[model samples]
Target: MLRMLKKMDGVILFVLLLLMVMSVFTVYSAIQSDPKLGNHHIKTLQFYGIGFVALIGIGLVNYKLYIQYAFYIYGFGIVLLILVNFIGGTINNANGWIKINDYLSFQPAELFKMILILFLAHVLVKRKNSTLHFWKDIVPIGLWTFVPFALVMIQNDLGNALGYIVILVAVLWIGNIKLSHALIALAIVGVTFFGFVKAYTSYHDEIFTFLEKANREHWAERIDPWLVPDKATSKASWHTKNAGLAIGSGGITGKGYMQGTSVQSGRVPYTYSDSIFVVIAEEFGFVGGSVLLLMYFILIHRMVLIALQCRDRAGPVVIVGIIGMLLYQVFENIGAFLGLMPLTGITLPFISYGGTSLLINMACIGLVMSIKLYGQEDEDELLMGEQRPTLLERLWSMVKKEKTTA
Candidate 1:
């Protein structure tokens, strides 16, 4: 069993372990004095153990098998998202979690990321000529991607829905789609966005009309706080204000773990989850922040290296999808903490205390290991729709072309 785990990418596994350790520390700090948090800590650890086992087990298998079930898994993921919208528990204005019981809950949006990767890999792996065009190549994939995004949006979970768009763009770029098609699509999106802005500026009535059609005042409220920040003195600015104070209080070296005044005093809202990075910054200061950032750089670098070595398109596409997920989460979380963006309820990837997110991320690493295990040799070229070519066959083709030219 140990050897099996070792067979996967060792760097990824090590990084994962480090992240898990960090999360436990954060969780412990969050609820060190409270019974509820202490109990949650135990439950979270147990789930993490199970997730680790699953990750290793998944790595031992061939990744191609995942491709076979991609569609079904993707379908199931969308269904779960839909279910969460109607019946899921609401926390932080986003109905993205499915209550499993009183003690545990699962976030379908997290699972949806993995499922999207599998599905995209299946479609793009066998694609001939990496030139993906919009109407011809991307539209079909967009249909599947958009449905889940729309459903998540309806649930008022803009953060996760935005994450889906990130994955789609990353995969499409990796697949080497036609550049002209991308420009055209961008133009269309730009035009629509401009129109909406103009309408909002010109008519107050249009804003109400749009809000009524969406059936959610949350969008307007979310922006109102940002636009007229002076009036929005509630939790709208809670994470931003507290996180800044935490960073300022730390100075250069840090206040030491559990010594963070803001975090320990519960002044930093969502410190255990969305604003966890702020806690790290406050306790460990710039030293810890730099180390965490460096770790992420190394992790992303390894993932890219794996993508480059993959002989099959599916493996590369999957890695690309994973990259997208990580990138969005990092930027969103950090940006929110720094007040660079609105306080979007996004987690800090492996560092955030979410069982579902952590498990799915480790599972993705397992899949990457499978790709490496079964990956073709570096020199072998994967033709779009053909078998390996013999040396003689290649020479004969070259000779025939020369003769015809003569």
Candidate 2:
């Protein structure tokens, strides 16, 4: 065990520790600012403890074991998502959480993200040599991706649904699909997105009327705040407005710990979860926030390095999916805080105070560590020319060959 520990990636481990320390401090400040939150930092500490255990436990296991049972794990995730729809408690109008008790809830979507990565890595690596055709290859991959995506969408969880989309794109890109096929797919997506935006902007009333008639008023309610903020008085828009205020107020050095007016006044909703970035920025200022972002950059860089050193296709594919997941969440959450993107209620991976998200993220790091520890040397090492003979040995071999020829 100590030997394995010694072999683990130190840079990734250091980044994880740095992020955890920051999370503890930031979560404590966030809870302290609001009297109603009631010492949530204690719970956050417990989660970190649990998450660290999971990280170490999974890191010690062979990552290829996950690849072998990838389908089974994915199936289990699907079942959980389906079950959550029927028995889950609603939070913020999304029925995506399974209540465990009065103070605990489990989000299947969080676990599903990891499972999707595993399954896709397994399937894509298995089909590495298969010819790429839309109907034959791409369609099956799309269907596999869309199943969990549609299930999450049904729960009105657009954030996680979008996360699934990112994972799919990452896996497909790394899976070595034909270049021409990938270009065509990208073109179709681009055209579709452009068409939707044009139609929404040019025919707002007609489109809204259609949405109302089709019983998609919820979608309208969520989108309207972003598209027409001047007239939006909804709670979602209110949250975004305050989030922006909190971020903008924090200039360079921040207002000091637990001293944010917006946070203390309880104006920013979801301070410890979705709006945690706002809390960090408001209290720690631009420097602190930049430090956090630097940690994330280092974490992602280390993961990419591990992926590159992997001996097999599965290791790199799995890491790429993880990279996609983290990148999207970070981009979406921070973008929403700055009002550059619509609020998507996605947690900021390690720093956010969510048990399920933190645990799953730690598990992902463990997987990467496993690849680094167990996977063989780079294929380039094997591809290098056979060991060269010493100068004397080479000369002796040449003399022997000449004698034979004579």
- Please, what is the whole-model Cα lDDT of each candidate in the order they appear? 0.77, 0.84
Candidate 1, residues 80-130: lDDT per residue as tens digits? 988887789988777888898887788898888889888887778667546
Candidate 2 regions off by >4 Å? 129-131, 205-218, 234-236, 377-406
The 10 consecutive residues of candidate 1 with the worst lDDT sum are: 377-386
lDDT of 2 by residue, 153-220 (tens): 99988899999999999988888788998888899999998797677667777877897797666665
- Number of clashing pairs per prediction, in order: 0, 0
Q: Model 2, 169: alpha-carbon shift in Å?
A: 0.3
Name the top lDDT candidate.
2
TM-score of each: 0.85, 0.88
Q: Which one is best on TM-score?
A: 2
Alpha-carbon shift of residue 72 in model 1 (angstroms): 1.7
